[model samples]
Target chain A: MNQDILVKAIDVTKNYGHFRALDKVGLEVARGEVSCIIGPSGSGKSTLLRCINLLERMDGGAIWVNDELIGYRRDGNNLHEISDAEISRQRRRIGMVFQRFNLFPHKTALENIIEGPVQVLGEAVNEARERAMALLERVGLADKANHYPSELSGGQQQRVAIARAMGMRPDLILFDEPTSALDPELVSEVLDVMRNLAASGMTMIVVTHELGFARNVANTVTFMEAGKVVETGLASEVLSAPRSARTAEFIKAVHS
Target chain B: MTTASLTSSMSSTAETKYEIAHLRLVPKRHVGRMVAAAAVLVLLAALVRAFSVGQIEWSYVRDFLFAPAILDGLANTLLMTVAAMCLGIVLGVIVAIMRISGNPVLSSIAIGYVWIFRGAPALLQLMLWFNLALIFPTLGIPGLFEMRTVDVMTPFVAAVLGLGISQGAYTSEVVRSGLLSVDSGQYEAARTIGMTQMLMLRRIVLPQAMRVMVPPIGNEVIGMVKLTSLASVIQYSEILHNAQIIYFANTRVLELLLVASFWYLAVVSVLSIGQHYIERYFGRGSKSIRSSI
Candidate 1:
């Protein structure tokens, strides 16, 4: 019921054929809040994040971003799905970082950051270029501005991805395992950029296996298991001394 | 302790030797390599002899190669190649998209178009288009005042339609496979940023797909330059047709045919450079760093 909530899910359910991806999954993220979703694979954390961004249409229930219903428009008692263009317009305000830094292979690092704003927003190309340069600088990649994704290390690429998501100036940025694909030594650099973004009061919902990042940067930590939210609470409490037995089991397993 | 101190003092005063690691050279020979070398030498010597002393009538070739009619025919061949390719590529992009658009009806129609055009012999298809006047007699809006098919369809028009449609069938498959080669993550990444399907195709999917599409499309373009000869059957005034007219009167069939072949080689040779540049343009961001072995 909080008016300041940036994203709210109301019993959302998703299915891939007969397999349930999200089963009555519900969570709320407030404005400027860093909400971390932690779970083992196939636990619906990524699905929930995707459903919020309207990348994947939920088969049942509803998701709201800033009080606007995503993917569908309600008419009387029924919900009619909107056109792709409309969904795209809504998606412009929700940036996402994939596990595999999906920067355009044909474009340079700076070009990748500028593409979304210039193409989707119809912003002036020169203006977008300037902003993209600033982003590149912010991510400690000003020197690598003209380099392609392939030319950079994994850590550098992920930093560029974070900067790219930030360029949209989105209301919410969903990171679906942002650092999971990086080399062990490369993970911290990406996490550092994400940490800076969190400190700057950017709204981020990260789905990661990095328990340390969840404990440190996230304001709220959510544990998901088998297409359901096992527990959700303040980071210090839920992570350190989770009330749910499944959450405790997962924490112990991760520690071991 | 006394032995250890004595060894330390001796080692500090000892001269170091710069020793070369032992290296051995074994005389290894490949029977396949020897056989290949012999074949290549034989082929090269044969080619040189043919060029220098072969009865190709080099003087006659020179005289007719730049003949005005031959030049005009060359022009027509080039025109047909460029025009048909333009039309084919436009249709190819559309049909390729339709094939993957997730619409059953559109996909089926695209598949049917490809199947019929690609499955049948191209020469047969060209003849059918040429003789279409005989089959229909008149072609237009059924009851809205039909025009005679002969008047409506000239040899050039028929040639372009037949060649373009046939080329399009192959181009569609090449393009479809190219698009499929791009990772699904690229599409999802573009869609996540609020990019529409068309925008994504132009900016994201197609650029990446262009890398895969170029080599095959390059082959198609080179093949098309030669395929335009098929239009000769429709009385299309292309190189081979013009060459035939010259040879039929003069009774120098091989000489005129050589002239046409000469022109084709020239055009395709030039196209190879353009293809290389286009491939390089699309291949920019794909280079990964590697250390020397």
Candidate 2:
């Protein structure tokens, strides 16, 4: 119910058959705060981020975005699953950037950026196109606007992906290891864009392995392990001086 | 530019270290390729000579090519092909979607439909449709209106239904494979962008699927052009049937047959050209093709 809270997940759980992917995961991200979830593979950091935007349905508990419960309607003691249209509408408030970039290969970078606005939000094509160009410029890809995803370098494609996520004017963006698929040299370009996005006061929930980006850019850092939040605190404290042995060990492993 | 740079770098390295002159490269010649080319040319010439000198009246073939009966038959063949293909493609897309749907009943129904139509021979399906009056006797609503099955099931109607329905079965599989060829990430991207399922399919998925689907669908269309001849069994009056009728009367069987063959070849060649352009259109933005201006 806090007005400052942009995204809140309480006791969220997800299961792929018998294997629990997320177990009682709870986190809250305030408006304009960049929160990064860091852990090893299969720790459910990505799953938790996915559940916050209703990309993966939670088997237990609920998620709220600005006091609005997502993916279901609660009436008295019963929960009615929302329709696909309703889910789609709710998803519009949250944009996601994938590790693979996942740009529409059939379209130009500019077209990819404008698709969400023109197609889903019914914004005018001309206006959407104008805004798309601006986003491309912001990501330093104005020259590659007409280039398809296949024509761009890995870093450029990821930057375009960021521009695409920004095109919809979402209140918050979820990034799932946005630079993991990039080459080592290409990683900084994408991280630089994310760093700028953070500096611009855009609320972001990033599941990433980029420890340096987390240490510098993220306001709050949450360490997850095996579907549970192992540690959550200020970025400096968690990365430099952790309370739990698990967080300290993870930080050590990542550093080494 | 890269090749030029590489050659310059190699020359510089050779000059600095090995003191070796740039090697003079000679292209290798394969005697077997030369022999094969000569053999193919000779075989082609002999075949062309045999066809020209064969026992056939060239004048009859020429005269009958554009005869009234043959022209009408050609019209009927083209019409039937277009009608059946339209029906088949529409039904094929629907069936393919159903086959991939989450509902068990719809998926199973699509499976059964494909199994039945694809399992039977095209000729057998045509016979069954042409003779359907024997089973139904009458069709249409029981109380509101009714008509004799024999009257409703004309050869044209029967042929279209038979060929179109069978074509739908094969096309459904091609379409399904095409849809599956799209990456899962594309679907997730569409979802994150807040696109409805139908909207995503139409705007995002189907266009990408077209690249995979068009080649197979072109093969099917070309196959359908020749398959229209099978309708002659039910007297649908296509090109082959008209050719047979003329030959039966004039006793110029080979000539009429040659005329029919020429038309079939001509139509299929034009269609092959058309298929090439369509493939090019869908191939845009793919790895092999350069971006448009």
Candidate 3:
């Protein structure tokens, strides 16, 4: 548990019935670093990322964000499970962008961005609107502020999702296949937003198959296989010339 | 060169003629079948006309349908319908919430409500409420007060209670389906942004669910509008019952029944058109509607 680590998962394990989704997984994400988790579908990469934000509760393990254990608290001899409300409160510190964008369709882009700030942070509507406008501008969707998610293109919607997560001023943001749903031509726009966010020193845990983006923007790359972290190191080491045989196979499979 | 151009044009024209000769247009047999079907329908209509046993008194039809008493009955019918609808919608929202509530007891209660009312016939429910005096001579509120049995169970009271309660059950299921039609991810997204459950329901869930629920509930409204006629069986004197009384006195049963049918048709037609516009309003922005599914 290094003090520099913004998130640390110690031997985290998650089971869905007989199948283990995450198996004794341990990882650390340092502050102000972009870490990308790459694996095939059902390789537990997305599940691991979800665990960081307590979106998917672990069956066994301890998760700490800024050294605060999530999903549980001990009082005397009793370990009281955290309520959903409490979990929601903790989730505010770590925003998540879903694969489907999950933008509130009933809300306009500007409103979606401001919703967290106004509702969770208790900011005034005017102040929330101001910050939302600035974030929308940053995401290059200032013109689409009043547009609903249905009206926006998939890439634009993902950008709005990014802006919505950023609205909370979270310490770290988790992206679960953010650009996977976008058209091939539109993928780069969302990846560009992520790259910009990474450049701005935002701590991020991105689960993606976009090897090129991982090589360019990610500071660290962790390759997962069958619910285990098979390789972890600098992005170049993992992406360019991986030491592990599984990593090499995965990279080759991705390339071909 | 002009002679060569004329020969080339003649060759192209000959090719067009060959293609047209090979084309098969509509078959003559299909037209013959259509005419045979039309002739059968005409024969059936003629047979029905020949078997006419009695004449309908047009004057009796006019009197029963347009009389002031029957019109008043129609007004009462409308009033009962509107009141039941308002109550049903309000109850529906509550029950839908209960069904989705985290508390098991509340959810089960909602489930039981939908089960019992929807399981039973609406007519049976009306009869049961009309004869509720047999069940409870006096319904009392402890620490509050009580009223006489007859006073507490009037026909008007019975009709509203019966119809509204029954409608609520069906409406709840409709509303729940609407709410469930929305993605659970929407709720999660709203909560992640820190909106309270109340705010989320009001701003996010209900508006979206309403778009899904409007058509079904509009169908329910039309159904309930006709269902009000059943209340007349308990001597509530709705449009149909008033027509029955008038025609029985005049011995013009067919005319009176026709009069009632005409009114029902009129109301239903208006409501059907209303339902269309409402469906259209919510259909905007929906992908399925835009694609004409």
- How is the predicted docking of candidate 2 categorized under the CAPRI scheme? medium
The lDDT of model 2 is 0.93
> lDDT by residue for model 3 over A123-194, one digit each (tens)?
999999999999999999999999877789999999999999999999999999998888999999999999
Q: Quick one: best DockQ, which candidate? A: 1
DockQ of each candidate, alpha-carbon based: 0.74, 0.65, 0.36
Tell me, by lDDT, which candidate is best: 2
Candidate numbers, best lDDT first, in rank order: 2, 1, 3
Model 3 Cα displacement at B172 (Å)?
3.7
Residue B67 shift from truth in candidate 1, angstroms: 0.6
Clashing residue pairs, candidate 3?
none
Residue-wise C-alpha lDDT for candidate 1, range B189-274, written one tens digit per residue: 89888899899999999999999999999999999999999999989999999999999998888889999999999999999999
On residues A1-256, what C-alpha lDDT tens digit does candidate 2 reach at each position? 2449988889999999999999999999999999999999999999998887777889998899878899989999999999999999988989999999889989999999999999999999999999999999999999999998899999999999999999988999999999899899999999999999999999999999999999999999999999899999889989999999989998899889
lDDT of 2 at B259: 93
Give the per-residue Cα lDDT of candidate 3 at A150: 78
Whichever of 2 and 3 has more lDDT, that candidate is: 2
Candidate 3 residue lDDT tens string, B1-293: 69999999999999888787667797566888899999999999898785464586677776666889878888888888898888888889999999999999999999999888878887788788888878677778966987766677777777887888889998998899999999987886776665667878887788889888998899999988899998888888889888888877877888888888898889989999998887766665565665774
- Show the lowest summed lDDT stretch of 10 residues, model 1 chain B: B284-293
Poorest stretch of ten by lDDT in candidate 1 chain A: A1-10
In CAPRI terms, where does candidate 3 land?
A: acceptable
